[model samples]
Target: MSMDAVTLPDLSGRTAIVTGANSGLGVETTRMLAGMGARVVMAVRDVDKGREAADAVRGETEVRWLDLADLASVRAFAKEWKGDLHLLINNAGVMAIPESRTKDGFETQFGTNHLGHFALTNLLLEHVTGRVVTVSSSLHRRAPGIEFDNVDLVGRYTPYRAYNQSKLANLLFTLELQRRLADAGSPVLAVAAHPGYAATNLQSHSGSRVQRALLAVGNRVFAQNATAGALPTIYAATQDVPGAAYAGPKNMGGQRGAPALAGRSEAAWNSVAAHRLWALSEELTGVTFPLTSSTG
Candidate 1:
């Protein structure tokens, strides 16, 4: 369907949690979902910034503090969450940045963009019934695949490479989540989306000055605005699609255009990798999802 032709379904009784809701595409996705009658929880690191963004939306929404870089914060938020959750948008992430580690000593990009969301999803699995949307990126194709030995990328750390690895992890998570859910006979859907080249502050953290400058200029010339970028995510969360579907703009080289079904990497469909990632994720986070070998 065309971008303008798409319409959100009614969500009067739905409750949604959107990470990174304080700005950019996350903010717009929360705004549109709330506008459609869903009660949104703005999961952000900055309460003040989240409040400001929430206040701008027309419908009711709450702000909750969550730091994806800190596992403690993630646990607290998950423990505090009550009632059935219709959606969980893993929209919070960091882009290219200088080598660093999370509070738990994981590589920064992999920690914040992959492990954090992995932990959060496991924590909230019981409460989630409808859909889980993971915000990945086209850059996922850049990485070779998961580095089983050096998942932390301790010795070999390049900003872009790490970022790509994290995005690939997102796809692995989505596909594995769907597989597990299907095995369990659960109704919850797991989907992924990329915003294409949207103008957002995510690039502000880039380690390369040249890359940052180019991003800034490209945002003005080539990138679409945040609202347009968020359409794929919104569609993934609300659409009546089957589990494991991926959404993105139908543009040249997947750059920019109307939102539609996008193809994932061949490796993303590997069930072995998916299962391996799931086991490693559980081990790393110390949070095991209630998954059986055969969910169905």
Candidate 2:
């Protein structure tokens, strides 16, 4: 979507928590949300960094420490937070990093990108009254369905493959969560969006020099800046979108343009897979959503 396309609804009295709000898309998202008059909480791993970023923006904003890779941190943040939450933006993620594990011992990519957000959402379900906007990626379209058995990539691991798995999980999680929320007669909506190919700090952690060089070139010539990349997210959060809607750029095969309803891959449409992933997430995270007893 065009960076300037979305005209945010007045979020005057609303409150939002934007994960990884210290950099890239998170920074822009926080800025825009604050501009719209929301109490933007910039949740980042580093409190000092978060405050620094928040200071750059003009509006009511707060900084909090949240290490999504650590479940304890997630629960702690939820516990300490007060009042109704109008928005929960799950935008923090790790891309193609080397083999690693979270503090909980799960594969770094899946744990940080999917499991962490999964646990956080469930834990804070009661607090969410409006919508949950989870940031996913176009790379998910290329993934095979999630490998339930080898989620951690113990013996078999490829940076891109693992990253793709996590991104796909993000979409599936959104689908199933929306289904359950609707079934429970809840007003909370679950939405997903992708930034397409945005130039962000997400690429800085990898160790591949060749990939870095290519990305540096591509980012300047082909990719949009973080501000434009954040339009899909802003659209998803502010627009009257339906549950499970996937928003992204509508130009250049969704690489960059104005925010619109983007298409999902066939695998992303598999309800059976989404349900299975939901169950797996509950088992792995030990956090359950507030569904009917029969549903759970």
> If candidate 2 were superposed on the true structure by all CA atoms, what would the RMSD be?
1.8
TM-score of 2: 0.97
Worst 10 residues of 1 by lDDT: 287-296
Q: What lDDT does model 1 reach?
A: 0.91
What does candidate 2's lDDT look like per residue over 1-296, in tens digits? 22365556888999999999999999999998988889998989989999889889999999999999999999898889889999999999999998988999999999999999999898888889999999999999889899988888878888989999999999999999999999888989999999999999898778799898888889889999999899899999989899999999999999998889999999998899999999999999999886673354
The pairs that clash in candidate 2 are: 1-257, 1-258, 1-259, 2-257, 2-258
Model 2 misplacement above 4 A: 1-6, 293-296
List where candidate 1 sits over 4 angstroms from the true fold: 1-3, 291-296
Give per-residue lDDT, candidate 1, residue 53: 96
Clashes of 2: 5
Instruction: Show how many residue pairs clash in every candidate, following the order shown.
Output: 3, 5
Candidate 1 residue 287 Cα shift, in angstroms, is: 0.7
